[model samples]
Every structure is written in structure tokens, then in C-alpha cells.
Target chain A: MIEWLAARAGWPARWLLALLALIMLAGVVILAASIGEMPIPLSVTLASITNGLGITDLPLDRIQQGIVWQYRMSRALMAASCGAGLALCGTILQALLRNALAEPYVLGISAGASTGAVTVLLLGLGGGLIGMPMGAFLGALAAFALVILLAAGARSSTTRVILAGVAAAQLFNALTAWVVSTSANAEQSRSIMFWLLGSLGGVRWPDVGLAASIVILGGLICLCFARTLDAFAFGEDAAAALGVAVAPVRLILLTVTALITATMVSIVGAVGFVGLVIPHAARFLIGPGHLRLLPASVLIGANFMVLADILSRIIVPQQVLPIGVVTALFGAPAFALILYRARPST
Target chain B: MSLEGHELRWMKHQTPIVDDVTLTVQPHETLGLLGPNGSGKSSLLQLLASLRTPDTGRVRLGDMPLRHQSRRRIARRLALVEQHATTEADLCVEEVVQLGRTPHRGPLRPWQPEDERIIRQVLERVGLAGMRRRRWHTLSGGERQRVQLARAMAQQPEVLLLDEPTNHLDIQHQLDLLALIRRLALTSVIALHDLNLAAMFCDRLIVMHRGQLVAEGTPATVLTPALIHEVYGVTAVVERSPHHGRLQVHYLPDLPPA
Candidate 1:
């Protein structure tokens, strides 16, 4: 049935699916937001969201309103944004490299962010609201610069760029581990470990606003290049013959992915598997056209992250499981299945 | 109007690979580019198509310098079918042909009726009208070659550049492919390895020897016994065929390691 639906979907049907997914995602997000220790009802959660939007009066008391509006809703939005951003980046990277397995981290941007964030958490660089994310974004830019320099010096093959990224990731990951292990106190170590594993606790409204804007804006910019990305499926020479300026397209996409990775990592600390897994699943669901795949991946990824966040909260009776742990628990098996199934065709 | 280049040169690793080449393809001419291995046929096609920039010279389409035209403008008027064009995606034949419409449309333009019409006509022209839904990985080598041709045709180009297009084709498909190119009556330059095929279909033949134009003229004027030996380093007899009235080259086998 899903195959029939995917095969029959025209432009109108695809847009309709996106619209339906958007509506379903809204319901899922609200229901998940209602699932915590406070245990607000779905009616109250919807009412709370509507009341905040000035659509209706507050149905819940002050404490209930605060919990839904100030805490859970913002966290949910952040999860959706991060998921959308990471998956979109993965989709672009895969096309750019022409490798099915390429993800946001394959370029070492996230590893560089981890190193910077760990250093800030341990040594207290700048020691304020602006310091942590700023440090991490800078680190990611530095690593990306190194990657570009290295790739330019070589033959400019996609494999060579990927190998260069692997080297950079190893170096940055080692630096991150050293920083965390040697300098962090036990209490700091506990908090750092939870974050490294992907925590979404205490992500307030400001982070949600910033992240959602970047994701949506970045997605729009990427959409403008959807045809160009499709041209790249046949490799750079074919794309060039089709009037795409290959170097600029590649460079702009790399910068965009790096920025997305840096921002998401700084906010939620390296939420692994979302980038790698969501895009492939979306590709399977929708045939791999970027114009369709981009929107579908965004919606599907948003749903996945929100559900994972909900599962993390409800798994332990009182404690929150790290979101990355839950994603990896599911993502690894799916990744293996994608690889195993891919062997007979190519 | 013609598509031509002047004194074009390109270097690879500081060594000249396409050195000081100049040529012309008159309107509706099927110019055959013939050369020995490493003799710059492919490099010259790339330069003419503006897929590669000349280190020191210019290509002109009609009266305009190619560098002055936008990439889109150049692509709309010129199409190139490379020797081994490949795509890793699981696209069907129709989707692959639709890609040729990229230069004709902008990011915001919806796929139009005219574009669809062109796709359908080109697929039919290449004898793949019924195979539009077939996936790329499932096709045979000759089918893939025809799909590439269909794609190039869909570009609606004024000048079509092809590099070794008959490399993977069966002999029948090879003949059919050349026939289709000739029937289309587009300004085309084809790089070919088969000397007799070039002799049979091409309006004029240009021979490249060591990155330079060694000879250029009508098929009868350019193809000769001595020229084949000089250009290909092989002994060959050339005579007009009774059936087609074109110079037919029959190559002599090499003497054993002597």
C-alpha cells in the first residue's frame, strides 16, 4: 500500500502528503508534550498551545500552563527543528558526495563542535550565555576550512574529500575526549556525559526560536537548488553540462551543512543517528527527488525526533534517558538493513 | 552561422594536452573527429562545448564568443554527450531524459507541455518510447547509450557534441545511432573510433594527430591508405564500397612482435 501510494503520488499528491504529514506531526507533537511527569491531558495541551496563540482562553491552571508553554512546547519545537535541519543536511550531503551513506558528520563538522563545546564546558571559556555556542560554531568553521584546504590540495575526488573528513573527525574526536576526561570534575562529567549522549532538558523558548528560524530558512535556500541537486546525481561533469556551476553549488551546500551541524550541536550536543537514519527512510518512502525528498525528510524527521524525545522522558519512571541512546537503539538496525538490501541492486 | 574555435589550448599537469587547435562545423554538418589514442579528440570536444575552458583561446557559437554567453545560454544552444555518462540514482528512462530540460527551465518554472512533448518525441526517436519506465540499472549497454542520445536530443541544441558515442553499442545500434544523428540535421561533431563508420556517415572528416589537426576535408579526400597508417600507426587499405560509395578501410593485422 505504501509502495502504491509512493508510486502514484504526482506533484499534487506529494504536496497533499506533505500537508497531511504536517497536520499529523502537529498532533503527535502536542500529544507527546502531554506525556511527561505532570501528565497533562491532550485537551489541556492543545488548549494551552491555542491559548498561547491567542485562539482561546487558558483552560488549565497557572502551573499547568507554565509547564506546557514554558517547558515542554519549546523542547518539542527544538527537537523538530534539529531533526529537520540535520536530515536536510544529510540529504544534501549524500547528493553532493554521490554516496548513499554520507551524513552531516561525515565532514567532521560535528566532531569539531564537540571538541569546542567540551573545552568550554571544562575550562569555562567566556563563561556566559554567548560563550558555548560561539566557541562551537567557530570550531566547526575551523574544521570545515581545514577540510576545504585539504581537499583542494588533493585531486578533488569525492573519496579523497571523504577520507580527509574522516581524518579530521578522528583528530577532533580525540581532542574532545582528552578535554572531557582530564579536566572535568565528577559533577561536570555527569552533566557533560548526558549532553554528549543528547539531552533536551531545559531548552527554553529562545533556543527554539533561533533553531526553528535557521532550519526553515536553510531549508528554503536548499529548495531553491533542488533542480541543481538533481543534476548532481549524475556527477559534476553532467551537472556542469546542464548549466549548473558545480563548484559554487558544492561550496555553498558544504557551508550550509556545516552551519546547520554547528548550530544543532551547540544547542543539543551531537544528537547522533537522526541525520544518518531519517533521510534514508524518507528516500525509501518517497523516491529520491530532492524537491520531494527535502520536504518529506523534514516532516518525517521532525516526527521522529519529537517521538524520540517523548520516549526518552517516559522510559525511566522519573529520569530522562538521553535521546541519542534511544535513536541509536533503533537506528543501527535500520542502517544495516539499508546496506544489506542495497547490495543486490548496484 | 557556424560553431568553431580558434587556437584553443589546454594543459594537464603543465603539459599541453590539447595544443593550439582550431576547427569549424558548418550549419547542419556532421563533422567526424578522428584521432589515435591520446590525440585530444575528447579534450577538443569538451573545449568546443565549453564544458572546459581553453587556457588561451575562445570558442564561438555563431557570431558570439562562447565566454560572453551565460552558461544557461550556452547550454540551451549546445549539448554534449560524454563517452561514459553515468548516474547512480535509480531513475527511470523518462526521468533521465527529463534532466536534459534543465537548461531550458529555471528553478521556479513548472514543467510545461512543450517540455513533455519534446521528451516524448526524443524517446520515440531513440526507439525507447516503450521503455520510458525502465530503470537505469536494468538497461543493457546499448540501451544506455541510446538513452544518453535521447537526453542530448531533448536539449534542443543547435550544436551537439558527442565523444565516442558508439563505444558500447552493438553494430546494428551503432549504425542506427549514426543514422539518427544524420537525420536530425543538427550541427554535430562526433568523436569516433571506427574509421569506416566515420567515413560512411560524416559530411567531412578531421583527423587529429598528437593534439593537432592533421587533416580535414570531405570523406573521400581525407581518408586514404597512407593517412590511416600515419594517423592510427596501422596499415590499412581504403577503397570506395560498391554498396555505399564511401571509403571503406580494411586494417591489416600486426606482424607477430617483430
Candidate 2:
């Protein structure tokens, strides 16, 4: 039925469909914020946001202000930014690897980030706010560099690239596990476990801003190379024949995606599924043109994350599930459906 | 507009694929390369297309060394159509053709009217105008080859390199595609397995045996019965086609033994 509608609507109508999805995403965010503890009204939440932005004179109580501004707003922003970043990374990775199964985690970016965060937490690198995230960023960069080295050495075939990613991911996972096992403190182990599963529970305004900047910058960079990404979808040799400087472009894209994935991992822990699910969802809406697919993936990813975060909050009474669990729960079934539907035709 | 390779030697895993071969294609000329399977026709074409770097030789486009130019710069002047169209993702016919404009387009500018016009003209030239929105996978083998041709044409290149373009095409479509290539005034280097089609379409023929160029000239000069027997180990009779005034080959099948 959707295919029938899509066929008649043309390309312009697809854009309209994407816009409608975006509106629905915004509605989900607002609804999510209103459903939490203390039951803040929609008008009160809107007024608080407006007041925070210095747009109106609608005054709110301090606790109400804290609820809207300090807690829910940052949480929502984190959800959206992480979602968008993961999805964008997934879209780029899929093109780069030329495999639909390629995602940020599959390439060891998440494992690398988690290892970094775990190292900092176990070793007690810094007694301040900046220690864990910085460690994760460096770790992510290291993993990215190692994967590039392996893939480049093997001449960058799709099979070799995936193998390199899998090898690096396993190495990092083993190292992270060792670190957690040897650590004497139970608190450190618990924290590491929480991070590996992912959460947006403790997001502050600064973390929100940082995540947003990384996502925005990374997203813009990816979009700027959308044509190159399109070239990659045809495989490396075809892209090279089309004049893409394959190795250098792949390196730069991998680095940029690594940076964005690290920033997200630092802020919200290692959220899965958003990177894997959102691109497929976007492809379902728009065709495989990277020009449309990248931006649409970002929007849909953000919406998916926000929706997942809302589900995490509402699934239990006064107890929020880790965001990663919710994403896995929703994403796995959807992924299965896509595979099942795609299998017959393929 | 001219392509020249000097003492070209290429190796794959230390096994020579193009051994000390020298060749040239003049502007507005079609040069057909013919060889038995594994005789390195495609490898030589890859060298000319700059898809592979020769181990110890130089390739020149006009007077400029091919290695010195950026890929985009070279792509603007020369385009290559590989044997198979194997993309991981599906694209419509028009979208695939539009990829030809990659070299001509600036990074910041969106698709302009001229790009669209050229793409449309090329698609029409290839007789694929009606399949503009059809997914590439939905197209038949012949249609896919035409779409690939349209993509190469959209490049508006001075030189075109085709590797076994008629591999999966029907005989009629193969003839039609070769005819289209002949009509285009661009310098073209085509690797073909069909000697008859190559003889009819190409202005010059280069024959390779065991990764070495054994003969080079007009088809009538190079495609002797002796050369065919020596290179392809097939006994064949070369005769004139009454319908087209072209040379045609009829191979003698081996007889069954008691």
C-alpha cells in the first residue's frame, strides 16, 4: 500500500512525506517531555522554554523551570543529537563499506569509545568533569586509525574492510572487559556497564551543547561529501573511475564519523540501533540518493532516538530504562522485518 | 584527444599482464582490441583508463603524462565503461547517467540545466529515454549496457574506454551498440571478443596473444586465417558479408571421433 502511494506521488511528494515525518518527530518530543514526573502541562513547558529563550513574559516557578529547562530539555537534546549522529555515521559507513550491514558499532567506533571511557573511569584519569569523555574521544580516534591501517593495507575491498572492523572491535572489547574485570572498585564496573548499555540520564546543558556541535559539524561534513558517498555506493573501482580519490576521501570521512561517534559515546554512552536503524528507515522513505538520504537519515534518526528515550522513561513506574535497551528492543524487530521483507526480492 | 602508451608493462602479483605493449589511438578513431580469454585485453584497457598503474611505462593523453594529472582532470577528458554494472545500491537509469557529470560539476553547485539537458540527450542517444525512472535492476542486460553507454556519453569525453561492453548483449543490441560507438567521433578503445563486429566497426584492430601484442593494423590486414589459427587456435574462414559489405568469419566445428 505504501509502495502504491509512493509510486504515484513522485519525488516531490517524497520530500513532503519526509517533512511530515519531521513534524511527527517534533510532536513526539513534546509529548515525551509532558509525560514525565510532576506532569508538567504542555503550555507550562512551552512557556518555560520561551522564557528561557527570553522570548516572552510568561513567568514560571523555579521547580517548574528546573523541570523544563534543567532536566527534560537537556535529556531531549541529548537524545536527538546522539540519534542524529549515530544515523549519519551509519549512512556514511554503509556507503564507505558498500555493505548495508555496516554501522558505527560494527566498525568498532562504539567499542573504542567505550574502552576509552572505561579506561578513564578505572584508572581515575582526572578528578574533574572532563576526564571520561576526553578519554573516550582519544580511544575512538585510535580505533579509527587502526581500522584504516588494516583496511588500507588490505587494499580496501568490502570484505577486507569489514574484517578489519570486526578484528579491531574484538580487540577493543577484550581490552575493555579485562579492564573492568581487574578493577577493584564495584562502582567503576557498574559505571562501565551502564556506559556500554548507554543512557541519557545525566546529560547536562554543556554535554548537550557539545553533542549538538559534533553532530551538526559532522552532519554538514557528510552532506558536503554526499556525492562522494554516492560514488562509493557503486563500489570503490567505479568511484575511482568517476574521479574520486578513494583512499584519502575514505580516511577523511572515517575520521569525521569517528569524531562524531566519539562525542556521542562520551555524552550518552554507547547507544546502539540508532546508527543501524535510522539509515534503513530513511532509505525506505527516500530512495538511495545520498543527497536526500543523508539529511533524511539525520532527521529520522533524531526522531527515533527521542522516541526511544521517551519509551525508556515511560516503560516503567518511576524507573527509567537505559536508552540503549529500548532502542535494541524496538530496532531488532524492525530490522528483522526489513530483512524478511527484503529477502524475497533479493 | 590522442591516447598513447609507451613500452607499457603491468604485473598482477609479479605475473606480467601487459608485457611491453606500445599502442596509440588517434582522435576520432575507434581502436578495437581482440584477444583470446586471459590474453590481457581488459588489463591493457585498464592501464589506458588509468584504473591501474603500469609497472614500468608511461601513458599519455595528447602530450600530457596521465600520472601527473588529477583523477578529476583526467576523467573530464576520458571516461571508462567497465564490463559489469555492479552497484551495491539500486539507482534509476537517469540517476546512473547523471553520475557521468561528476567530473564536470563543481562541488558546491547543484545539478544545472545543462547537466540535465546533456543527460537527457545521452539517454535518448542510447534509446533509453523511456527507462529514465526505471531501477537499474529492473532493466534487462541489453538495457543496462545502454544505460552504461549513456553514462559514458554524458561525460562528453574526448576518449572512451570500454571493456567487453557486449558481454551480455544480444547480437542485435551488440551490433547497435557498436554502431553507436562508431557514430560517436570520440577516440574509443574497445575490447571485443566478436571479431566480426570488431571488424565491421573498428577502424583499427590490435591483436594480443599471451599478454603480448602480436598484430596491429586494419582488420583486413591483421585478421588473416593464419593469425586467427595461431592466436585463437580456431580454424575459420573469413568472407565478405553480402548484406553489409563487411568481413565475416565462419568457424569450422570439430568433428566427432569414434
Candidate 3:
């Protein structure tokens, strides 16, 4: 039935699907804002949003407006931005490395960011809220540089790049664990543990703004290189034959993806599975064309995170779970299903 | 495109694989390189395609030295199709062909109607229009070879370099692919293993033995049974085929121990 529809509608169906996904994303955003211990009604949320935007003259109470516009909206926007950024990073890494199993977390950028953020948190770099995110960003950049240095020695093959990412991830994970153990403060340890497991809790409007800029800029950069990414699907030599400057292009793309991944990780810890899962889901929906694959992955990723966040809010009333935990709960089963289905065939 | 390899030399791990060899290919001509295994036919092809640099000598396309040309510029003039197809992801046939336009496209440009027209024409030319949307891995070996050919064709290159293009193809596909290439009339440098097929398709044949050109001429003048026995260590009867107006070979089996 899908194939019939695809044939009859031609390429327009792709646009239609994207439109439907955008509508669904808007619904998810609205629904996410409405849920929580202090439930905000849809009408009140819309009014608060308009009032915030200076679109309506309705006189609403400031506390309710603040809760809706400042807190809920910030968290929801962070969720969407993180989702889109991570998914875009995954898509670029998968194409650049030509590996189906690649993701930002799997490649060790997340672990590196975590170790950096944890160091700041444990060492008490600053009392300011921005300390952890800033530290994480720097750490993510360091890890990215190390991976590039390791992978650059062998410019002809992708084996070194994948191995370098693996090594970096493992080393950082161990370092993070060591930092957590040696630290004396109990509160710091608890904060570190929560950060490592990932969360969308305590997000502010500034964090959302930062994440949105990084994600949109990174996604646009990736889209610019979509044709090069397509060439990479045929492997390094074929890509080179097609006139792609393999080494430089790969390095630029790796840096871009790492930067975006680090930005998202800094904002919301290391949200796993969204990067790995959403790309595969998007590929299944729209073939492996990066042009379509990218946008679809973004929409689906945003939807997935919002849904997971909503589930986190509702699953245990009066106590909100970390959004990352909810994603793992849902993503693990889906991953298992894909593995079981793929195992026999392979 | 006119390609000139001036005394090309290549070494692997300090061991010389291709000795000083010079050859020139003019536009609108097909040059076939034939040799035994490890005779550096593939290496020379790679050098010509600029995928690898020659150790000691320079290669030039027209008046521009290959070393001076950017990868994209070289790719605009020359396209290469290697024997092996290694891909980690599943891409559809048309998508693979569309990738050939990488050199012609800028970072921000969308796909134009001209690009689609070229892809369509190349796909039809290779008789792969019916399987345009099929996953690359789902195709048969012959179909994969044709798809690769289609991809190279989509490049709109002035020169095409192929390494063992017919490695996994059936006889019919082998003939069809060569016939299609012949009709394209682009300057092509192909490394072929089968002498009879090379004789039938190539305008000129360069035979290599131990990284050196042993003979260079039309097949009828260069491919005698004596040279074949010396280079290949096989006894074969050579004769002209009635159907194709080209030389054909019939190999004689080795006798039992006596």
C-alpha cells in the first residue's frame, strides 16, 4: 500500500509525509507543555505563548505565564533541539564512516563530554549554572580533536576513525568513573550520576536558545554536504573517484558532527539511542537519500524525544523521571526488535 | 580527453610494482591494457585515474598536469569504475548513479532538471531503467556491473578508466557492456584479463609482463600463440572468429604425467 501510494503521488508524498510529521511535532510540543504536576491547560498555554510573543492583549497572571513560557516551553524546546541535533550528528557520522552502527554516543563524544562536565561538577569549577555546560563543551571539543588526530594518520581508510572514536569513548568513560569515585562530596556525586544518565530536567530558556542555534546551524552545514555524504555511501575510493576530496571532507564533516553532538550533550547530558534509533527509523521511512533522510530524522527525533519526555512525566505521577531513562525504556525494546529481525537475515 | 603517462613508476612498501612506463591515450580512442596477474595493469589504471600518484613520473591530461588539478577538476574530466564494490549501507540504484554528479554540484545547489535528465539517459543507456529504484545489494552481479557502468556514464567524463569491469559478468553482459562503451566513443583505458574480449572491443591493446609493456599493437599483430604461451604459460590455438571478425583462442589442456 505504501509503495502504491509512493508511485501514484510520486515525490510529493515525501513532502506530504514531512508536513504530517511537522504537524505531529507541533502536537507533541503542545501536549508536552500541558503535562506535569502543575497541569497547564492548552488554552492557557496558547495564551501565555501569545502574551510572551506580544501577539495578544490578554491579561494573564505572571506566575502561570512564567511557568508556561519560561519552564515548560524551555524544557520542551530543549528536548526538540537536542533530538534534532543528535539525529543530524548520527546521520552524518553514519554516512561519513559508512557504518550502520555509528552514533555520537557509540563514537565516544558523549562519554568525553560527560567526563568533562563531571570534572567541572566534581572539582567545583564554578558555582554558576553555566559551569557544567561550558566544561562539557570544551571537553567535547578536546575529544573531537583527539579523535581527528588519531584518525588523520591513515587518510585512506575509515577503520582508524571508527577505532579512534571507540578508544576515546572508553578512555573517557573510565576517567568519568574514576572522577566520580575519588570525589568526596555526596551531593556532587548524585549530580554527576544524574548528568551521566542524561536528563531534560532543569532546562532554561537560554539553554534552549543555545541548542536551537547549534542544531539549526549544524543541520544546515550537514545539508550543504549532503551530496558529498551521498558519494560516501559507495565507500572511500568510489567517493574519491566521484571527485570528493575524501580526507578534508571527512575531517570537516567529523568536526561539524562532533561539535553539534557536544553542544547537545552539554545541554542535556548524553541522551543515547535517539541518535542511533531515529536515523534507522528515518531510513526505513524515506530511503537512504540524505536529502530526505536528514529532515525526516529531525522530525522523527523531535517527536520521539517529546513522546519520551511526556512518558517520563506521566509514568510515575508526582515524580518525574529523567527523560533519558524513558528513552532507553522505549528505545531498548525497539532496538531489540530490529536486532532480532535483522539477525536471521544476516 | 588526451591522457599521457610519462615514464610512470610506482612502488609498494619499497618494492617496485610498476616500473618506468610511458603511454598516451588520445581523445575518442580506447586503449586496453592486458597482462598476467600482478603485472601492474590495475596500478597503472589507478595512476591514470589519479587515485594514486606515480612514484617517479608525472601524468598529464591534455596540457594540465594531473598533480596540479584539484580532485574535482580531475573528476570532471575522468571517471573510474573499479572491480570491487564495497558499501556498508544500502543505497538505491538511482541514488548511486546520482552521486556521479558530485563533482559538478556545489554545496548549496539543488538538483536541477539537467541532472535528472542525464541520470535518466545514462540509466537507460545501460539498460538499468527498469531497476532504477532497486536496492544496490539486491541486484545480481551482472546488474551491479551495469549499475557501476551507469554511474561512470553519468559523470559525463571525457575519459573513463575501468579496472576489470567484466570480472563478475556473464558473457552476454560482458559483450553488452563493451558494446555500450564502444558506442559511447569516450577515451577509455580499460584493464582487461580476457584477451579475446579485449581484441574484440579495444582499438589498440598494450600487453604488459612484469610491469613492462611487452607488445603494443592491434590484437591480430600482437597476440600470437607463441607470446601467449610465453606470458601466460599456456598453449592455445589462435584463429579468427567468423562471427565477430576478431581473433578467438582455443586452449589445449595439459597432458597427464607420462
Candidate 4:
């Protein structure tokens, strides 16, 4: 079915799929906004969002409007942005690194963020809420730089890059563990652990604005390199021969991936597996052209994350699970399935 | 455009792989690069293609130094078909061919009808029109090489650099592909192990031995038995073919000291 549409419609089929994905994304985001402890209706949720946008401005109940707009809408939007950004990062990394296993988490960007956030939280490295993200960003950059340094030595193959990432991830994770053990009291430890597992409970409007803008801007920038990424299919030398400045393109894309991953990691507290799995899912659905793959991964990832957020809220009786745990529960099995399916057929 | 290399030298681990090689190919001339294994034929092609910058020299395309030109601009004029260019991406033959259009199109520019026409023409030319949708992994090694050639042809380059492009092709495909490349009449540098094919197709031949250009001449002049013995460690009788009037290399089995 996918091949037929792609063949028949040529380039337009991707846009058509994008439109379908957009509608699906909207539906899920609305559904996410509707479900919660307060239980607002779908119509009210839609109205509240439009009212918040100052589009329709329909008269609604004060408390209901505030809850829907202020809490649920922000959370859901943040989730979508996080998902979209992480998926974009994954797609770019996989293409540039030429590895199916390449992702922000695998590259240790998320682990670096976790270590940085833990440092700020427990070691009092930074002052407040703003400090945490900045520290995480710096840490993420540090880890990425270290990986690049290690990988850029003699015979800088893709496998070497992945190995460097593993080393960085392990080092930062150990740092996080050390900080938590040395400084955190029991109460602080519990909250820190929850945050590390990933929580949307504390997100608000500013975070929504920040995440959405960053993701959209990042996605647009990446979209512009879609052809360049396609040039990399046969590897770096082929891309260079195809007129792509391989070094500059790889640097720009990897930096963009790092920034997006770090920003989302700071905002949502290290949500795992979405970046690692969503691009593969998107590739499986659509073909491997980055033009379609980028947007498809973004839309599917957005929808997946919003639904996961909904599940996280309602999975237990009167208790919200960490969003990361919910994603890993589904992501791990899907990851395994992808590995099995992608295994070499003799 | 004419392609020239001026004292091109590339070193790996302090040892020169392409040792101060210099040559030039006029526009539309097919130059053959010949060498035994590890003799730097592929390295010379890579340097000429600007995929690797020479350690101590420069390559030029027409009037401009290659390094002075942007990669995209170079790609617009020169296309390379590397030996073992494979991908893990699940792409079809058509999709792989379409990537050849990367240097021609920009991100925001819509795919032109001209681009599609070119791609279709190249695929048909490579005799893979029926297999446009065939997955890349399913194709045999020869088929992959043909697909890669089709891709390079789609670039519509003025200069083509191929590194052992006929490696896995059958005899028929080898002949046909060489004929097609010769017919294209682009300034081309093809690294080849098959001495007869190089003699049949290339306008000029340059033989490399131990990272040095040992001989550069017409195939009749260069494919001498002594040269073949010194470079390839084989005793080969080089003769003009009665059928096509090109040089043919016939190797004799090594016998114990007689």
C-alpha cells in the first residue's frame, strides 16, 4: 500500500501522509488534553485550546478553561515538541552516523543531561530552575565533544563513534550515580529519581513555548538538509563526491541533534527510547528518504509521546507513572522487534 | 572540462600511496588507470576526484584549482563511482539514482521534469529500466555496479572518475559497460585490472607501480611483456588483436627454472 501510494503520487504522497499524520497528531493531542483527573470533555478541550490561542474565544467555565489551558495543554504540547525534536535528532544521527542504532540516547547526550541535572539538583552546582537546563546543555555538549574527540582519532569509523558514545554514557551515568549517593537525602533522592525517570508534572506555559519553538526551528533547519542527508546513504565519501561538504554538513547536523536532544532532555528529564525507536518506525512506514522520513518521524513521534503521556497518567490507580518508564515499557519491545526484523537474512 | 593533476601525492602513515603523480586528460578523453593490487590506482582516482586532498600537490578542472571550487560545483562537473559504495539504507534503484541529482537541485527547489527525464534516461541507458523499483540489497554485485554507473550518469557530469567499476561484472557486462563509457565521451579516469578492456576502451593508459606512474602511452606501447612482468610479477605476451585492432594480454603459466 505504501509503495503503491509512493509510486502513484510520487512526491505528493509524502505530503498526503504528512497531512494524515498531522490530523492523527492533532487528534491525539486533543485526546491527551481531554483525559486527566479533572476529565474535561473533548469539545471543551478543543474550545479551551482555541480560546487560549485567542482564535474562537468561546465563553467557557473559568476553572475548566484554566485547567485545560494551563495544565493539560502545556503538558501535551511539551510532550509533542519533545517527541518531535528527539525523533528529528534520531533521524539525523542515524543518517550521518550510518548506524541504525545511532540516537541521542545511544550517543550519551541524554545521559549527559541527566548527569548535569543531577549535579545542579544535588551538588547545588547551579542556582535554580533555569540553572538546571543550562548545566544540562553544557554537559550534553561536553559529552558530545568528548565522543567526537575519541571518534575523530585514527580510523574514525562509524563503529568507533558508537563505541565512543558508549564510553561517554557510562562515564556520565557513573557521575550521576555518585552525586545522588553522596548528596541527596531520602526525600530529595525520591524526587530526584522521579525526575530522572522523566516527569511532565512540573511543565508549564513557558516550557511549552520554549520546546515548541526549538523543535519547530530545529525541524525546519534539518528539513533544509534533507537532500544532503540523502546524499549520505552510500556513506561519507559518496556524499562528498556528490558535492556535499561532508565535514560541515556532519558537524551542523550533529550539533543540531545535540542541541535538540539536550533541550528536550532538560525540559522533560531524560525521556528514553523515543529517539531510538521512532525513526525506525517512521522508516518502516514510509521509505528512507529523509524528505518524508523527517516529517513522518516527527508526526508519529509526537502522537506516540502524547498517547504515552495519557497512559502514564492513567496506568495506575490514582498514581502517575514516570513518562520514561511508560515509553521504555513499549519502546523496549518495539526495539527488540525492529532488531529481529532487521536481522540479516541469509 | 579538462582534468589535470599536478604532482599529486597522498601518504598514509608516512608512506606515499600516490607518489607525486601528474597527468592530464583533455575534455572527452577516456584515461585508463592500470595497476596491480596496492599499486595506488584507486588512490590516484580519489585524489583526482577531490574525495581526498593530496598531501603535496593539487588537481585542477579546466582553469580553476579544484580546492578553490565548492564541492557542489565540482560535483556538478565531476562524478565518481567508488569501488564498494554500499549502503544499509533500504532504497530502491530509482531512489539511489535520484541521489545523483543532489548537486543539481536545492532543498527548496521542486524536482524538475528535466531531472526526472535525466534519471529515466540514465536508468534505461544502464539497462535497468525494468528494475527501477528493485531493492538495492536484492541486486547482485554486478547489478549494483550498473546501478551506481546509472547514478553517476544521472549526474550528467563533464568528468567521471571510476574506481574499479567493473569489479564484479560478467564478461558481457564488462564489455558493454566499457563501450557505454567510451561512447559517453566524457573526460574519464577508470581504474581497471583487466588490461584488454582498458586497451579496448580507454583513449590513453597510465600504469602505476609501487605508487609511481611507470608508463603513460597508448596501450600498444605500454602493455609490453617486460613491463607487465616487472609490475604485475607475471609473464604476459602483449599483441594487437586482429578482431578489434587493440592490444591483448595473454599470460603464460609460471614454469620451474628451465
lDDT of each: 0.84, 0.84, 0.83, 0.87
Give the candidates in order of DockQ, highest first.
Answer: 4, 3, 1, 2
**In candidate 1, residue B111 scores what lDDT?**
90
Where does the lowest 10-residue lDDT sum fall in candidate 3 chain A? A337-346
Give the alpha carbon lDDT tens digit for every residue of A207-291 in model 4.
Answer: 8888898899899999999999999898888998999998888878877887787788788888888988999988888789888
For model 4 the local lDDT of residue B127 reads 89
How does candidate 2 fare on TM-score?
0.91
Best by lDDT: 4
**How does residue B253 of candidate 3 score in lDDT?**
74
For each candidate, what's the DockQ?
0.53, 0.51, 0.57, 0.61
lDDT of 2 by residue, B155-199 (tens): 888999999999988999898888888888799999999999999
Please give, for residues A86-167, the per-residue lDDT of candidate 1 as tens digits: 8998898878777665675767877888877787767777766657777787778777877768777322665667677788
- Candidate 3 residue-wise lDDT, B1-258, digit = tens: 799999999999887788888898989999889999999899899888888888889999888899857899998889998887767667789988888888999876988999999999999999898988898778887888888888888889999999999887889988888888899999999899999899899999888888877888888888899989888998998999998789998888787887
In order, the B-chain TM-scores come to 0.96, 0.96, 0.96, 0.96
Scored against the true structure, residue A139 in model 4 reaches a CA lDDT of 81
Choose 1 or 3, whichever is better by TM-score. 1
Candidate No. with top TM-score:
4
Interface RMSD in angstroms for candidate 3:
2.8
Tell me the spans in candidate 2 whose CA falls farther than 4 Å from its real position. A1-25, A56-58, A124-131, A145-167, A340-346, B237-243
Better of 3 and 4 by TM-score: 4
